[model samples]
Target: MSIRRLMPGRAALRYGLIGPGTHAQENLLPALSVLDGARLTAVAARRPDAAAEAARRWGADLWTDDWTDLVDGEGTAEIDALIVAGSPQLHADVVPRALARGISVFVEKPPAPDTATLEKLAVDERGAPEGTVAFVGFNFPYGQSYRKLRDTLRAHGTVRTVDLRMVSAKPTSPVWGCATVTDSLLQGLGTHAVDLVLRELGGPDRVTARRADIGTDRHALHVLLEYADGRLATLLLGNYSNRLEYRCELVTDQSVVGVLDDFNTLTLSRPSRTPGVGVLDGKETLRHTWPGRRGGYGRTGYSTELESFHRSVLHGEPSDSPLSACLEVYRVLDEVRRQTGDRP
Candidate 1:
């Protein structure tokens, strides 16, 4: 079916959330509340008290401790979509359940604990009725800086090499990491970096990853993704950092674009062919300060991504982050785990 035909002329789409935790508290829930044509219908948490509290805080009509009841309930009547932000271990079950009932799923990173589980989830995804879609919450891809940067790179030409770094403080809770070393850090956070690289250079032909235990079970990561088209992306992950940091540098034949962490600024520099020592800046160079697209650090980007998802699901179009993208992410993460010996 064509995506344009599924659009509902004038009605708000309802969404349900499974595992409404800190991320939900800080980002998703707040974002959903303000979006037009989208409603927060239900929320489920690990504990009933937390679920009830989130439901109340987020204005969800229903709160439950059991995810099965929420996802398996009547089809899209109470909830048009499901967001699985729970632990990776639980996603394998929750996402499949949601899809079986013909509901759209927006699952957070890692997808599952291990390759086999992720494979099972992929298999289940195939069985989902056509038009059913799933998304992994790789928020960085939808960022204003990233979107503009990616578009610029694609329009100019192929990206030959990319150097990326992602650093975050040790998670507040170890449950997020679970049994695996640095559990979801490399999978959850790394997923974002991987997705960006793939989006910029398509899928890679080979991926190699290594993990080191700095102090918090997982500390450092060195990943190399080689694309068949000769583009390469190198990822560096660090958790034992003082403050959160994200940096991406894309070097192409035309120019070099660098985006600083927190979307603070973007610098585009192209060296001149002149025989002088070097060119610091040129007339063609563009220095774009932060807040170029949206007001703050991705405040509007998240809203835009969610709104796009709502429109896509309602219109039966390709989801903002489709199931195929989710599968590729899982495939890359699985290979990373296999190389790093970080299976859960």
Candidate 2:
């Protein structure tokens, strides 16, 4: 059943905002305004002053500096759900509080800073109200291109191999202001890339990563994930490139599919004849384009993801992104970092 049928529509889903920071103010709040069936009831920041300022500027009904005020105080009941955008450290403390109070949560990525906190969240979620959903915002998963890829793979057959590459200029300002580009790159971009890889390949049994220190706060990483079934996927990620580049190629026995330019493009190619193995020549290529709407931070995809979680919470339906799926990704990150000797 559609999540809408199971819960009160957007209007019924009372939403709140925690951590009224740049991303929340710039992306999430504006996105929430346009998403159907979701309401922005309040906002809370680490500082009461900041929360009050955001509330005044953003039209939120209530504002508090204390996160507990939103989860345990009068404002707590005002919101049936919250989008937790606090720093990575705050997640370990605040997310469980919201869940303990029966409020549904949609956390920003790197849901927690490290493995220990993520593990605790897994346990806390079990005691949450049945059907109370928690989500980690790997917004790319909800992209039209990926949805098509998932659908296509299911309709066609299993993929034999996948190659995904993403290289971009090092993050600027606050992204780099906190940590070296290398540490932040893997934690930030790697999380998104790795999550998508796991989603596409199911899971990787063996993961070996090689890293090169290109510069401060930036490193080039080559990650190879091997599945027990012999399926393999590779990820090339680094903050050293000058241009903004992102693309993924999925190969099946029958056809090769490409998600290019960060899902901005999708192409399909079939070989002229079934070659025994190896790459096909340029002559054996066909392409297909799937046009989709695009706008806003993250292409209006964040709104779609938020709306999905809001509905899931109200109707008592399973979340599109349940905590288990989130935990899987965390486990992957834990394993990868362990192998790479990367710690945050």
Candidate 3:
């Protein structure tokens, strides 16, 4: 009873979008042009003018200020899938409703404002119609550099340790109605870091250490994760930097080291010959860089994640970033909040 079988010979799947913000305009909307078997049929935003402008610019046939128009009103009947790129609060409100109607959803990262809301959303997702696909946008794992790193790690032996750092410029104010700058960072940016840890090494047994420097408009956090085994992972997340940077280094038991930089470059260092007693003994390096022209939408995995949602909706395939999978990551995030005394 696959969705594909149910809708025989449908040439293209229609999509409704909520939130025509900068992120959607710059990334998601542009991605629709290259997406096969799909088209943007409608768009809804908080402001009437924004919705109108987005529809005009992106070739969407319908536009409305009230998101309800897409969720349960006029636009709902026209769309097979809904893309939610608004605030986490909006996601909390819209995702469940869309699922109830059997509409597949692709929500941006930080799926909910808090872990409890995300947990509730998971319950709603489970109760959703048989073939509904609920996907969150943890796109880092889908990036080319991270994919290469995963392949390299698989070719090698067990990973002993992982070090991840994600930093970005300070925000002028709290994002998406988060209680504080620190809360916003942990929920928004830190989710990706935690998701990456879970992808590489399963859930950590405990959060060994947690520290944060909370400020009025900027924040920094350091967290250490220890597995039951000897494996370890550390995350340095912050929004007080001069620019955006993302890097991850993985060390394996087979004397292999792989580094993924900024979701575009991967560098691996391995022993070229039998290890000598010296520290810098015979070793060679291999580097792979994504083409600069491919653009961030593809290079950073926005397109890939969207396409995954498309396939899951059309073919009834399980989503790669389902809400259930996010529970563990949020468990770690909840622990971080408790340890750091961050509210909301």
Candidate 4:
């Protein structure tokens, strides 16, 4: 079945949300609420009370305990798009069915629990209706600071290396059906790092070296990616920090260095005319910071990602983070999982 295209000045694209958890409440729902191009038509969750509460809070037209109601039941007829903010396993299950019905989808990161399932999703996306989009929510690349860093690197010269570190004080408890804390950490946290690497440096020739400190309470993973031309990228991911943090550094062959701090600030330094001059003492340094009024959703890319997905559905534009693009990230993640023996 082909989806109905929105006529100019018609009603906003109707959206059905599945898995209205904390993440959805804090990020996706709030973002959707503010989008003029999207509407919350329905909400579904594992618990009826939660679903009802979310619908009421978010001003959705309907609520249901079974997610299938939004995908295959009466609610399906009312929705033009689906947002799956569930677990990786649930994302795997829900996305294919939604696409089969000609519904565009915006699924959260780590789209599936494993590479095999993600491959199937890629195939399903290819076979879906021509205009149907299967967008994955890897919002880090949409961050203001990171976007600036990409522009800075491109304008500077050939990129030589990229270093990214993401760490958070996430608990060891398995909240998403992952069997081990290490597995949870990799899927929950490390996928973001991997996706960032792929976006910045493309796929590496190979993962040259990897190290891990997997403990009962704290976990850390370090991966070194090497290119055929001697370029390099390093990923440092951990769940042992006192707070959530993201830091990225990029170096270009033109003696330009860019640093992004916590998705809010970007600093770029160009080589000075005089030799052996430090950036601190040089004149060619530039800094940009996200405005405080934009809020966390804008700084962290959630709002931009959600808005982009909505625009794609309304205008027949290609998804920025389509399922096909996500497969490469999963391939790299699969390799990391194998090397670290962090299978669930």
Please report the TM-score between candidate 4 and the true structure: 0.91
Error of 2 at 82 (Å): 0.5
Angstrom error of the Cα, residue 198, model 1: value is: 1.5
- Expressed as tens digits, the lDDT of each residue in 165-229 for candidate 3 is 99988554677887767777887678999998998899998795466555666677899999888
Candidate 3 residue pairs in backbone clash: none
How far out, in Å, is residue 81 in model 1? 1.4
Over the stretch 154-233, how does candidate 2's per-residue lDDT look in tens digits? 54456878888878886632352234455567677788888888887787888888788764556788889898988999
The clash tally of candidate 1 reads 0
Per-candidate TM vs. native?
0.84, 0.85, 0.92, 0.91
In candidate 1, where is summed lDDT lowest over 10 consecutive residues? 274-283
Could you tell me which residue pairs clash in candidate 4? Answer: none
List candidate 4 segments past 4 Å from native.
1-10, 274-284
Q: On a 0 to 100 scale, what is the lDDT of residue 151 in model 2?
A: 66
| TM-score winner between candidates 2 and 3 | 3
Better of 2 and 3 by lDDT: 3
